[model samples]
Target: MGEFLIDLKVNKNYIWVYFIAFYTLWCIRELWLNLYLDSIDSVPGAVTSAIIKIIIWVIPVILLVIIMEKRNPFSYLGLLYNVKNGLKWIGWASLVLLFYSILNITLLKNSIDFQLELREWLNVVLLVGITEEIVFRGFLLRKLMDSFRFWIANAITALLFVSIHFPIWFYKGQFEFPYIFSSILTVFVLGIIFGFIYKKSKSLWSVIIIHSLYNLLVSLFY
Candidate 1:
C-alpha cells in the first residue's frame, strides 16, 4: 500500500502530505459523524456533515495551494473555469438522469418511493458536490494525475472513495455484503465518470454538477 506512494512527492512532498492529511482527517470526521453525530440521513445531519466536510476537505486543499505557491489554487484545482465547456459536460451527463429515471419508473416504480426536499437538494448540490469534488476530483485527482496516468489515478481515487464510504455505512448498518459490494461498484464507476468529465474539460464545475445530480437522482431511488 505504501510502496505505491513512494514516488508521489512534488512541491516539497506536498501531494503525499496532502493525501495523507486529508484522508486521516476524513477518517476521524467519519468516525465522529458515524458514532456520535449519526443523523446523517436527516436534513440537519446532512447540513452539519457538509459543514464538517468543508472544514475537513478545504483545509488540506488550501494547504496544498499554500505549499505549491506558484499556482493559483482555483487553477491548480481546475475549478470554475470555461463555463461553456462545463455546460457541455453537464449536457453529456444528462443521460444519467434519463437512465436513472427510466429505471425508477420501470423496475423500481412499485418498490421505490420518490420525494424531493429543497433543503436536501441544496445540501447535496451546493455543499456535498462542491466540497467533495474539490477534495477528490479537484485536489486529489489533480495530484494523482501529476504522478500517474488518468485512468490509474482515477481508479485509485475511486477505490479510496468507495473504501471510505464503507466504514461509515457499516457503522450505520448498511452492510448486507451483496448490497455493499454493489454500492461500492456503483461509486467506483461514478468516480471514474466524474474523473473522466474533469479530464475532458479540464474543469471541476461540470464534474461537480454531474456528481450533485447523480446524488440527487440516486436519492430519488431511495
Candidate 2:
C-alpha cells in the first residue's frame, strides 16, 4: 500500500492532496498546542513550543523527502550550501536586514523588549526559520513548481503560508483588525521574497537566514 502510494506520479492532483494532508495535520497540532500550551511569553512555554514545532514540521518533511526523493532529506531541501555560496547568501541577507531595520526604525518603532539570549536565537533560527522554510519554500514550492507555472505556484504558496499563520496569531490575541491585516500582508510579501530566493539560489539556506534575522529584528523593534 505504501509502495503504491509512493509510486504515484507527482502531479497537480497528487500535490494538492499532499498539501491538504500536510496542513491538516499541521493545523491540528498547532491547535492542540495553543489550547493546552502555556503563553509563549513565558520561557518554559516558549521552549516547549519550539520543541513541539520542530517535531511537528520536521518529521513529516522527512517522510516526504524519503518517499518522494529517496535521498538525504537535508540535501533534498537544498541545505548543502558551501562556504562561497553561504557567504553569498549572507550578503543578500544583509541587504534584507538593512531594509528591515530601516523600515522598523523609521515607521513602526515600537519599544518592545528584546530578550536577545542564546536560546531565543537558536529557536528563531532552528525552529522557526529552518523548519518553516523547509516546509513552505523548500518542499511546497518545489512540488508546486513541478505542477504549475512559477508565478502561479508561488502565489498559491504565499497565500497558504499567510493563511497558516492566522490560526496561531488569532489564538495568541494578535487578531486585532489593523495588526492582523498588516501582519498578513507583510507575511505574504515575505513569502514571495523567500520563494524568489529559493528559485534563484536553488537552496533553502538563504531564505532561512533572511527569515531568522527578520524574526529577530521584529522581536527587537516591533
Candidate 3:
C-alpha cells in the first residue's frame, strides 16, 4: 500500500512536470511562429515549425528517458508498429475520416485540390501527425493511464488537447462565441476517437497515419 501510494505520487508528478514543460514550450513555439510566419514564406515557415516541434515535443523526452531512466524510449513512446490488428484498426480509422472527406466533397459540394504545396505536405501531412501523436497519445495519454483507467486518462488528455488549441483559435480570431465552443467540442471528440484508435491498435503509427490523412483531406476539400 505504501509503495502504491509512492507510485501514484510519482505518476502525478510526472504528469505535472510534462504538462508544465510542454505547455511552456508550446506557448513559446506559438509566439515564435506567429512572429516568424508573417515575415517568412511557406517553406521556411514549415521548416522552422518542424524543427521547433522536434525540439519541443520529441527531443526532450528522448533525452530524459535515455539519461534519467536509462530505458529505450521507443516502446515507451509507442514507436513500435509490430502489434496485431495494426492494419485492421488503421483501415477502420481511415474509413471514418474518408467518410467525412467524401461527405464534404459530395454533399457539401466543397471544392477539391489535388495539387498540394510542399509546406502543406511537410507540415500537415507528415510532421503534424508524427509529432502530435508522439506527444499526446504516446507520452501524455500513456502516462496518465498509469494512474487512471483508459477512458479517464484519455478524457484528461483530450481536454488538454483542446486547451492547447485555444492559443491558435484566439490568434486566428475565431475564439469567440459559438464558433469557439463548437470547435473545441469537435477537437475534443477527435482526441477521444484518436485515443480509442491508439488503445485498440496498440500502434502509434496507426493514429499518425489517420491524423495525417484527416488533415490532408481537410486541406484539400474543406
> Whose lDDT is greatest here?
3
Per-residue CA lDDT of model 3 for 1-222, tens digit only, reads 999899668746765787788888888877776667664346677777778778888887777666644678897777766455667877886788778877887899999997887667887688888888888898888878877899999999999989888877766678899778899999999899999989988888888888888888878884
The parts of candidate 3 lying over 4 Å away from their true place are 1-8, 67-69, 81-84
lDDT of 1 by residue, 1-222 (tens): 575466333453676666677778877877876675546667777777777777887776876676665577887787747779999989878886887788878887734445565446656556678888888888878877876889999998888778767666776788787788888888899889888888998888898888888777667665
Ranking by lDDT: 3, 2, 1
Q: What is the lDDT of residue 32 in candidate 3?
A: 72
For model 3, where is the 10-residue window of minimal lDDT?
Answer: 33-42
Clashes of 3: 0
User: For residues 1-222, could you state the per-residue lDDT of candidate 2 as single tens digits?
Assistant: 876666655433565676687678778866876777556546777687677777767788788779767878888778885535656876978886888677767787656566665446656545688888988998888878877899899998999899888777867789897778888999999999889878877768878877887788776774
For residue 102, model 2's alpha carbon misses the true position, in angstroms, by 4.0
lDDT of candidates 1 onward, in order: 0.76, 0.77, 0.81
Ranking by TM-score: 3, 1, 2
Q: Candidate 2 at 28: error in angstroms?
A: 3.4
The reply for model 2, stretches above 4 Å from the true place, is 1-14, 36-44, 81-83, 106-112, 116-125
Off-target runs (Cα >4 Å) in candidate 1 are 1-12, 36-47, 110-119
